[model samples]
Target: SPPTPPAPSEPEPPAPPAPAEPAEQGQPFAPSPAGSAADLGDAPSQFPNAVPPTQDFDDDPQGFEQPAPSRKSGLRARPVIALALVLALLAGLVGGVVGFVFANRVFTNNGVNPSVSLGSPPPPGSSARPADSVAGIAAKVLPTVVSLDVAGPSQSDTGSGFIIRSDGYILTNNHVIEAAASQGSITVGFNDGSKATATLVGRDPAYDLAVVKVDKKDLPTLALGNSDDIVVGDSVLAVGSPLGLTGTVTTGIVSALNRPVTTGDSSTQDTSFINAIQTDAAINPGNSGGPLVNSAGAAIGINSAIATLSQGSSGSGSIGVGFAIPINQARRTAEEIIQTGKSTKPVIGVTLDIRYTGPGAKIADNAINGAAPVTSGGAADKAGIKAGDIVLSVNGRTVNTADELIVAIRSYKPGDTVTLKVQRGGSTQDIKVTLASESTTK
Candidate 1:
């Protein structure tokens, strides 16, 4: 369903969910004359979305407050009566409790303790370390980042990419260069104003990853970090040319993990499922293929898509919902592509029932579209995964949809062992399935 077509004509990755807001005419995420960062580059490689909300969109609506349950989460709590209470208790040998209570009430007002001197305090603004902020990480990674200008025969687009190997090997979204892979020119522009022509080495549409190479051997490259180790709430910096703004930097936190995100419309969409790392980072047009680095300046994800309300003439902007392909998946795909002219995907050996509206991914009882419900002697078939079985999870990761099941399986490399939670015959069981290589399975 994916990665097999390395041709230039492969359809673009799923278009980010554009806001339903009616603009003038909805357009794909390409460098437009209306947005910022026009002069930086011409090829924009990112997604489209709506303007971000001024307030926290995910903030839970405050319910009606209950009496007597006030908390000063936003205030600084100063313990001013502690010393007085302790001193009173020590002074009184027997009625110390009575004396301490009297002192506490007199010194405290509405739980607002007076600011008491607690030895010498650090100077104002002494706690913040400049090196620990997003700017610090950006400074370390921006040099390794780059912008790509692709001039296709039919259309031109601007996108972003980053240095992965000092020998001029670059990593980026396959969608970024898909339109220009065969009939166009791709120019790699560095932060220092130097530009070089880059040629595609290999690409995998299944993972939306590609590797391109320049002539230089001394390009700055970013170190790939372990995506499996990243946690929610981790501070991150997204560096790229959002809307063609070169060297643009945005700060955000990991909003979710293992997010099952599939972009594209019903007509032309990649069959591969992307298990993305969700972030609130403002990824916009031309930010695709950019690096999502952590506090330590390690690249953990590639900014790929942004969720929008709908598409229109106003075009898609950032809605604070962005998805990044995990570095773990990207790294493996890129490496395989660099080594070989193509990449292999992991398959579970079953044709999922996409139309089934059931809770979990349902395997079709009958063959549909020439693909059998279960491949004979394939991984799933070997593990006794039948046609009616409903897959509930993968290695403890709950999967409620066929998209999720596919994404979860793809997260693991072929030849790796994984346990699938399946429902069969009114009972549930954990079946161990060793993933089969897409090439072998097919």
Candidate 2:
């Protein structure tokens, strides 16, 4: 009690509070400096477990202390980082230059882009044709084919032909050179790019054939084959200058035989009757007079006409139906023209009754013209073909009209025997007659 009286003399100014403990291990805290009461009044509280206002706390809930980086160490690291950045930039620059150079070398050729590649060519003779192949036959036949150009006073036309004699005797259609026969010119063009003026040796409008001669020797000629040997389905090639296309070659098969074809204008006497060899070859207007060859490259027919669906100046192209003059008849007519400058037509020596509209070709009962219905001592009269008789057939081929009978009779050469089925009043009889030759004139 006496010591108490000594009184808490100057209660040692509440010993400054201890510093707060760090929230985590290794964290340190600093205490505020001693100050007067007034000075410390505005200052943070110095109580234990309380933080000083001057001190900063970590944002982490569990306070973690990060060491302050040294200024000297930061200065030293700045140069190292700058050096690394500079090296990276230099490396990028060098890589870009190398890539540009490599790309240039790979895509450029003397500063020009390369052309498209098609690979190497095929080996020679890999597509060689046999001797009997179409190519081979064309090679052998093309040289013999000739193009005919005719120039008339009012018209000019072109056709095709083939060599028939080595002395430059060429065979063509009468219609081809007909315009030139009177007062025109005819020029023959060879496959070898050579040309010659041709003179008409002979022409037969009835047979639609002609022969032209050129002052040429050793000319290649085509071999004439027997048309009788060629039946239906036989392979044939038609060579001509179609549409003025020189050396044109087309192939097909024999479609029919003994087709009666009457061509030319009926108003004129130039009308021709032909026992045609029908084929599916592509024949056009310019193809007239060209050779229709067999598989052996032998001339079997002469391409003469094409059947068209329409007719006019606009004209028409091929529809695969073509007619050719049988080479047998052509041969006979050609021979006669060559030997005597004329040809002949076989006749039965009877005038047809054009008014008779019966089922068969009829003979006139009386003389319509000044001539007799049946010529005396001629083929028909000698064979007992009476006037007013109807010819039912010729050589086993049916004849329904006067034209059919004429065409059938003309199909045979003169002096050839033919059996004609004739219908009289009430009897039908087969009469054998030897055809007589009648000369044809221009």
Candidate 3:
């Protein structure tokens, strides 16, 4: 402004040389030392805390920027960290592998093979027992046991039987041949591999017993043992045709004796009998008619029935709860059927004092009240007795309970006469009557 601002210089001092070119793009240019005063129009506005080229680490400003790390130093430090991480990972992997190997070794030492095969059959001749060493008892009893095959119209059944005498007499379950009895066929297979046709002599369904005869006489037979001598827990064996696989042998201990069971005529609304021996030895449909033997292999009872899964499927296999008819009862019935063509159980002439009810049976006065001295068309009816009479004793044995009467009655057989002391309306009288056989035909 002093020398009268020379008329605006040409091109205005080249616009102050457009300020020196900025150091780089987006940077303000530095002041040029040779610039005239007027060329340095107002300096560019200063930015707050902006870094300066001449600033020293000691003290150019209260805060300053730190220099960036050198590329070489950063690269060297990176390798050391990477190596340490790699070593740690490698050590962890080695530890895991060592632990797995040690654990597997412990399991293998305890008979656990992680990679072994199982469930395959043992090689032939490597059985647990010697093949040639037959049970001494089995050898003795096998000859007496026979396989029975009976064919009916609707069913073909197989059972087991045993020769009871040298002269062709055989013992088996009555149901075994019952179907065959109706114009069917019965065959017997002996232990010697010989088979023969057999004739059904007679059968008693009430007792679940039957007698048959084979053409071959003088066959080897087993002697019957007394079933009364048996007790609970006695070791026993079962010989039978299980699943139609003939000559099956199973061993067990006697679970119980005198076990009463209700069996027979599932189709009929009313039919059953009691008295049995229970054993855990397996007995199935085909096992019926087999022999329950002792360790000595003597026939003690006849296998008769099994606790079935259901009534409709009686042909299924056993579940260990099997029943056998006591040999004593069977022996009695078989002998009678063979000789008389029928079997009979003892009975008292007087009507039962009461229908079996409650824990123990008791006498009902009306059971004999207004009734004829004897039942019409019965052994008691023929004895000339009147109804309304109570039975006080039988054969001089006091009969307080119906069970007592049954026990006393079973002591005698049909055609046997017994004296009964009767109490009629507060008075007692003596009467005698002969027992009769129960009709076998329905």
List lDDT for all candidates, in order. 0.82, 0.86, 0.72
lDDT per residue, candidate 1, 1-442, as tens digits? Answer: 5668666886889988665443233343322222234222333334334333243322335422222222343232445466678777777855777778866865775665566557887677744447767766777899999999989989888889999999999999878888787778899999999999999897777777888899998778899999999999999889999888999999999999999877644365444468999999899999999999999999999998888885564658888999999999999888888777678888879998889876889998889989899999999999898997899889998878888888898888999989988898899999999999963110
Candidates ranked by TM-score, best first?
A: 2, 1, 3
lDDT of 2 by residue, 1-442 (tens): 4554554556567877676554343223333233423123343344455433442333335444344234566677899999999999999999999988876766675665355477898776555677588998888899999999999888888999999999989999999988888889999999999999999988888878899999999999999999989999998999999888889999999999988888887788788988899999899988999999998999999999988885554658789999999999888888888888888888989989978776889999898758789999898999889999999999899988887788899889889999999999998999999999888856
Q: Is candidate 2 or candidate 3 better by lDDT?
A: 2
Model 3 misplacement above 4 A: 1-134, 266-272, 309-316, 349-356, 362-442
Name the regions of candidate 1 deviating beyond 4 angstroms: 1-129, 264-269, 311-315, 439-442
Q: What is the lDDT of residue 30 in candidate 3?
A: 47
In the range 206-255, model 3's lDDT, one tens digit per residue, is 66788999988789998798888899898777887877777788877789
Candidate 2: regions farther than 4 A off:
1-115, 126-128, 311-315, 355-358, 369-371
TM-score, structure 1 vs. true: 0.69
What's every prediction's RMSD, in angstroms? 46.6, 9.1, 11.9
> TM-score, each model?
0.69, 0.73, 0.57
Rate residue 228 of model 1 by lDDT.
94
